[model samples]
Target: MFNGLSFEKLLLVGVIAVFLLGPDKLPSYAAKLGRLVRTLRDYANGAKVRMKEEMGPEFDDVDWKKLDPRQYDPRRIIREALLDDAPAAAVPVIKPVSRPEPAYLSRQKDAVPSQAHDDSATPFDSEST
Candidate 1:
């Protein structure tokens, strides 16, 4: 939730808070904010546990551990739901396109160089290419 909080933002917030509360009371104010954040986090976690317990089997299929925003995209969820709702036969069947067979050579001369090619032996002909 607070993963987007950066050092710059934090520093700016701290400066604003200090200005509002005054330097003398800044430490106490920061400590109170810290406690509030911790309390909020604890309450959120408790709520999650309570919600899981209340939902029970209804939400048992859901993987709450993977609830991060990156994995819980709305567009992807809608697309998957749409695909799941569609009847199997309703989707068009696609036959995989077959590849053409490779040509086969049966002659030994063809395996070697043609008559137009030089048969002269070179020092490193095998490695040069």
Candidate 2:
């Protein structure tokens, strides 16, 4: 439980506390610290019990590891979304759109522009003017 602190560090802290507080006040401080820890543990237990009671028996059946925030990865989620287990033949093929050639391109330069090219309603074409 004390993964961040080793026994040596704890012993050093205790020795420092003894010197700072003096021997007379150390015992009372230790008692207060113990009570604080006990109270915190009681509160935590009470909260857990209350939560269990409110959530019903289904709470115990939940997969806690699956719900952990550390398991979330945007890259993995997007990769899964783009991938599928179905065979290639099961997927649909989308053909490109075919449009009639504009009259201006096939006719002489002196020829008048067609209504389709002159009209503001004409769709934009990036490859051709």
Candidate 3:
């Protein structure tokens, strides 16, 4: 079932194949392709049958569309989780604990003198410049 291929595209591919393979060998190649498709179909059917046997009757009841990985959207899942109808009171409130500043940061702050109120010109190192 070439669902993705348009009629024009199929025609173009067939024309190209005819030119490349020639009319003499085309029939044999087409037969081989048909057999390959048939074999693949049989293999898929066998796998399905094996899965059905291993899973039992519940396999028939399974929501295959719902189980599809393509149907999962992380954004939708997170939104659903965030908008769940659990009572606000039941949710624990996390309070941020006041922590003492790190020793290095405290020392740095202590080392730097406040210059906000100072009107004096800043001293510059001529050698560094």
What are the clashing pairs of model 2?
none
**Candidate that would win on lDDT:** 3
Regions of candidate 2 where Cα sits further than 4 Å from its true position: 70-90, 96-129
lDDT tens digits, residues 1-129, model 1? 899999999999978987898999988877898999999999999998998899987778886678756777789889898889656676687998774433322332356655433546343322234
Question: Deviation in angstroms for 13 in model 3?
Answer: 0.9
> Which ten-residue region of model 3 has the weakest summed lDDT?
115-124
Per-residue alpha-carbon lDDT of candidate 3 for residues 20-72, written as tens digits (9 for 90 to 100): 99999999999999999999999999999999999999999999999899989
lDDT of each: 0.75, 0.83, 0.84
Model 2 quality (TM-score) = 0.57
Give the runs in model 3 whose Cα sits over 4 Å from its true position: 1-3, 85-129
Query: Candidate 3: what lDDT?
Result: 0.84
lDDT of 2: 0.83
What range of 10 consecutive residues in model 1 has the weakest lDDT sum? 100-109
